[model samples]
Target: MKKHIIPTIAFALFTTSAYGQSMQVGFSNVTTVVPGGDIKICKARYGTGYVTSPHKNGAKIHKSSDKGHFIHITKSNVTLHHDVYVMANEYNMSYPGDKGEITAKAYVYATALDRKSGFSGVFSDGQCKGQLTISAK
Candidate 1:
């Protein structure tokens, strides 16, 4: 009885450890536009984003459902406020030479994410330049 109990306990512990908790994140009411008049959606379309040093207090902003995603700050290469934290995810844009609207792009899972002091993400031109306007849906 003792031997059987120990084996079962050990197996349960091992299984629980192996299948650890996974992170959950969501980005709704998302909208972004480019200087040329294009939209940028940072949902599952591209992938997860990065939350820079300003937009966070520690390594990451775990509770994002409360504070909205700061898409503008992540694109301007400048701090939104004194300390603008954010998610460093990917997005898509429609560059029709200032004659386009925002639309859902695609989704992807990235390997890692990075934090920065300025804008660095998906854009219409892919250069991180131009007006990458972003707001809640």
Candidate 2:
């Protein structure tokens, strides 16, 4: 009983200290522009991750708009390794009359100690291209 109690307390302390240092990060107001074209905007951008199993790490850039037409990016899967998280998604473009698939990748990093973070990435669909930028605190 004594041996089990000592190990249990040690394990609890280790896990608590590990998770206590992590920050819940959020980013917002995604904006992008492609050269020779108008600017694009997205409603919200956010990312989250966990060290525990059965919980997934993911990020999203959503409700993008161009000239009053709306495009919703989704909750795409992101890979979290240490301090960085990354994702790449390819899907059919669903604009009213447009026809193509867009490919995008996001790379972001956050310190376990800080709440402020930012990221910039790029995406393209045939002739259409843009960069995504977001900052969170």
Candidate 3:
């Protein structure tokens, strides 16, 4: 009887502690494209990409989500703000002797019941280059 009571209490404590805990969601591939023109740019793949959140801190994509020249995430990346989930990245590329910088951003809305959500944002290189969109596809 004492053993059973102790086990039940332990389980209850564990359950309550795990409630509202941070979590990571992984995706095989998420397409990133330029808006309006619908031009294809890059993709987030390799199966290492994921979005994580800290309980009620909101969703976030860490620096490890980077995929080559396509997207480069940094420690300062904030995928959500004011209850909105916005993912952003920065990458550098070089052509011959010239070097260039690229930045991409996307906002995604998802709930526990949502299997998919609409994602869209902007990409810039130097100037306010262009807008881009993303989708889990």
Query: How well does candidate 2 match the true structure in TM-score terms?
Result: 0.33
Judged by TM-score, which candidate is best? 2
Regions more than 4 Å wrong, model 2: 1-67, 91-115
For residues 71-135, could you state the per-residue lDDT of candidate 1 as single tens digits?
Answer: 21112111112333222233333322323343333222221121211222333323222222122
Q: Rank the candidates by TM-score, best first.
A: 2, 3, 1
* lDDT of each residue in 13-104, candidate 3, tens digit only: 33231113322333333333434432233322213334322222232322222222222233223233343444343533321112323343
Q: For candidate 2, lDDT tens digit of each residue in 42-89?
A: 221221211221112222222332222223333233333454434444
Residue 38, candidate 1: C-alpha displacement in angstroms: 3.3
Stretches off by above 4 angstroms in model 1 are: 1-20, 33-37, 40-137
| Candidate 3, residue 131: lDDT | 39
The lDDT values for all models are: 0.26, 0.32, 0.31
